[model samples]
Target chain A: MAQSSYGTENNNFGPGVAYSQLDAALLVYQEAGGRVSATEPTLDLSIHGADGRVLTGGLVADAVSGATPNGAVPSTVSQNFVTPLKARGSTASVTGASGGSTIIHLPPTPGQLATAALGRQYTVAPNTLPVDKGFRDHRGAITLGWSQPLGAISDVGFGGGFSRETDYQAISANAHIAQNLNSANTTVSLAVNSEFDSSSPFGGIPTPLTVMNAQWKTQASRNKSQLGFVLGVTQILSRRWLTQLNYSFDRQSGYQNDPYRVISVVDPSSGQPTSTLYESRPDNRQSQSVFWDNKLDLDPFVTDLALRYYKDSWGISSKTAELSERINFGTAFYLEPNARWYQQSAANFFHYYLVGGQPNPAFASSDTRLGSFTALTYGAKLGFALNGRSEVYVKGEYYQQTGNGHPADAIGQLRQQNLFAGTKAAMVFLGYSWDFH
Target chain B: MRRPLLIILMAGASISIAGCTAIGPKPWEKDLMARHEMLVDAYPLLIAADEHIYFSKEASSGGRGFAGGGCGCN
Candidate 1:
């Protein structure tokens, strides 16, 4: 990675308001349209038996370039946050499953699915986060799931999976029960999920809210646990219309901070960042979300609409809306167009920099993700089926993110610059699947 | 908040229980409902990959089901 010497030109770095040449250079660089891009290629394969049993697998490779978030504030004078970076990686997985009335001999109608799967993935995401940009991580996981019928009108299912990564490990389990009433015209479901995680960033952890120590001493790993529950209902409104509503609540405790992130220390009045310190976060978080999805079948055209509302304990809240339409060209080919809009509020303790004079808050971070932002995504998919047994599809999407750079408290030259100008990226996918007896 | 969530769940349950079969498709007219595309998650793998991408880039997660693999991304 080639880093320009933008910081070396400034020497009179001190407290209070001071001249900040770095900010001017940064605004110019951003105005010149410099950004990052990422690519992901994936291949999916599936085989099916006449008895409702299925086996599936896939491989995904990713190539990412341009600057990701570095926790440090963007140079007020030059291009710092948009670092020159690159990374490439891949993941592979396999799974076997059974569904519909595979177990019950009677009632050929669809029941549910039972599945078991094992997967492994390895990735080398280099030049991303500051901590050992050459970070290499791999993970392995296995899951088993089963759903059984309760008489003729209800069903119950449970599943669990354990995954271990080079530095992070997680174990999760879930159970759900559904009841079909009014002659199966309506279905109600309640489910619960729990996860236990152990994470240890590479190069060891650092003391929170402290200046970067050159020694980079090692610290013990941390643990976290999460529990969530969901309630959902689906209704067959008409012959061509269906709708679903779901509400979910989640609580997570223990280590909730990213070990690699840091907070920037800046001049109290000028808002010029002088140095960086490790970031810290609260140990617990709770959140809840509500989602609604609707689908309409209009002969050769199918349309889907979804909306979601979410809020968390960290004072972060978000809303998401998505729409997609599928145009079928007979039974052999189809084209689906999709669009999504998302907006979020910043965390309560989020800040671009910690002022030199003010007392440090209990927790603070400069990570861009913790700031208020809006994102828009547009994509489309085209699929082709070969003789009804095999299918191939291609999908492409473009995403743009914009942050609220100016806050009421922004000081000095900082008020003139768009610290969080914006980020743009695109992704493409090509996949194929086959079903055989 | 808890009371509101409980009320919403109860309302949904009540609606599901009160609905009648007369407004639904007949048993023999269930062909369209049984189609693969009619399933909520028609393309599981693609959806999974899409979820992973969003999870890594955004701060919010889990509108679908849980039990997903964890990552160091966020």
Candidate 2:
């Protein structure tokens, strides 16, 4: 037997853990099959490093809000429920299914009736977020790269660094080789990078799809590995302009899901949530991207324009356009304003929520990143040169994301709620860089 | 691994010979091209930070850098 808090308005019961458990099991199976590494595509891959060792580091703070997962808001009472689940670990139980298989009990929605009538049990969902739907984080990272002349016409760069946050950590090593030709007017470069990461989220690792209220097992952390390669060419189109083209490929494998996200299990006909299920995703992904960038210098001002096309094995694709202008205020200071537009197609398994009675899909996630959406970023940077060897800069950006939140075939009350509510985030960065001979 | 390596070899060969046949800036005319602002990646650290933020928040990855890790950003 299981106890359910659905009778109360607190929506205290979270989603199920079995979904996540199954998801984890699937990932294990995928790993047993094989693993791959992934890379990112950027224009800088082929650039020659500064002659001396240059060290760069920054501190970034970000504030994120208005990201309502699946746009599923709890009842007024639950919204006011002051007791955060983070204070206490959820408890759940598993029972033998009809053919000796195991069946897990998951948490019900705000108004769902207790499952005692159906001879089923219920468990709470994982604590994926605070009821307020906002969070803040700080991050810091630093890298040092030095280039050595390989010959009269070639150079090689070696670098490594790490980025750290409260819950995530990554360490990477990279190398690039560049060669000049055509009277030094044209250059070709190749770069490769490998990264490893370990993430330890708060509340440990959530057992996929396990009943949140039920006592399920959890791991303290998970790991991921990535590998990338880039091939690029830079051409001096004229005295005041330059252009570059690059193609990059990357592959990643290991745990790949937000430990705290969940999907609503809704009635097929009514579109009303019956229960909540923790989400899961594939363990391995491979992606590639192509980019083109052009820069034009007009004495005191410079303009940079770029375009990118990206696609991945998960059936996700995206296009990005960016433009920026740097205006010099004498030789000591500069102001650069930048804007970017991005559009992406949803992952194949992206769904607002799974229908309650349908057979669960092999993969499913309510994470908005996997959904179709458009995002815009507007930002500016102010930089000052302290001398020939050092500089300081401050930058800020406002990012907004929006997408189709309502499905045409949505059932009952779901048609009235916005599943794709917009999300906004703001970030600020303070950075310093210097070169040492 | 093999494919990326092959592409690198091919691209290197082509680029090394491209200047021999192409018409563009001369060696002496590349002074401005050597400026940091003219480089595709003018701000490496800032770009790295931005990529990290977007990776944590977005579903798609692999435009500016390789995917590094799976974050529990939610």
Candidate 3:
């Protein structure tokens, strides 16, 4: 929930604002033609399912005689307060009630799918962990830019902005120079840019004691760094079609390890378990990506497609292809159905469960996020252009990862293929865009 | 090693035959493409913001651009 002192007089203030802020707010909103953005900002306080059937997937081979399985109900977490903010011209306009579901995670651990009692399903109530997930309640990003003609088919731009949530915050500014040329009836353009990101690691497991224990222990810490240059292009194939190409390279050189992840190893001679903590790589890592996008106007509707090929030194490589068609049901509304396919090669140090796998002497922790896998993404978004000036768009996406697990992993139960686990996420964005001269 | 070669080849081939890929309003169409919401505008601010969020949280990229920076997220 966000609360605003400037617009307290009126409950919901859009372009219209209080007498003092009215001019500034409207001025900022008009500057870019205008843009408004806001995410879920949920305040759902319903008690999630914690009726005991939610078993903790610890695989202890022995739960204390009286210990009960507990994975469904997230730790004692509930948003007690919320301070949502509304902004214009990169400044806060209103701060709404903030307290709400921030990090909602669905249940079912990777290990629990097998070797567990099946009868528990009926007894387990639907567990809805309130979004006690991230470091902060609200996240917002704003950017303003300008481009001026430098030549027949060329333009230049300079701009910057800052964004932050609870655990992550970034301040970035960039400069780009572009060029375009006429090829018969076709048009081609290219650009080069530079930007940076300063961030901290609070995205993964929240609890240190729990998430990074046993074979796949991992911890996280704050990371601050600079992300360098990129080059891109755009092509206008014809009046009915358009295409674009962009490439970027980034190098994060700083602390690169989970301060919290840990693992247990057994002594060779003595069959006893000894725990070892894993840390980030001592050397800075590198990442590079290449992307291409095309949009074709099929009269009433538009078909858009994008393909990206990416690779990094961390033993991870991937290719992603996505397509979305925006169907206009007239000037009032549009519906977009999207489908995407992604396949990735595992990171060098990644392992399913590290107990009996090849250990990387160079890096301490395995990058589970980059395990070998193929994932399919499907979703839809409905957008309505309201009053010919404002718009509201809502989207829902369901993603499931299916891939072959490396046969050599010690913990075969956690393989990506056999142990199917997925996440469901939906976003509702209320945006107001107006073109002002 | 292989990636660098591919990138080099892509840049070389793209620039050498760059004329063949050209189309439409030339750089003149930038005014419309530069529009705040046009999918592939000359500006990097908004697209950068969106890509930043996507890279950190999700596993997809929506913008048509090249590689980005290195971080310790993985």
Ranking by TM-score: 1, 2, 3
Model 1 interface Cα RMSD in Å: 7.6
Candidate 3 per-residue lDDT, tens place, A35-108, comes to 11123221101111122111111000100011111111111122121111121112322233222222111232
Candidate 3: tens digits of C-alpha lDDT, residues B1-44: 45673665388338534655443655554433332133554222
What's the candidate order when arranged by decreasing lDDT?
A: 1, 2, 3
Candidate 2: regions farther than 4 A off:
A1-146, A164-166, A214-216, A384-392, A430-437, B1-20, B69-74
Between prediction 2 and prediction 3, the one with superior lDDT is 2
Q: In candidate 1, residue B55 scores what lDDT? A: 74
Q: List, for all models, the DockQ compared with the true complex.
A: 0.31, 0.33, 0.24
lDDT of 1 by residue, B1-74 (tens): 45665676678657755664655777677656655566688776667667766776677777765523465556
- The DockQ for candidate 2, computed on C-alphas, is 0.33
Query: After best superposition, candidate 1 residue A232: deviation in angstroms?
Result: 1.2
- The alpha-carbon interface RMSD of model 3 comes to 7.1
State the lDDT at B32 in candidate 2.
69
Decide which is better by lDDT, 1 or 3. 1
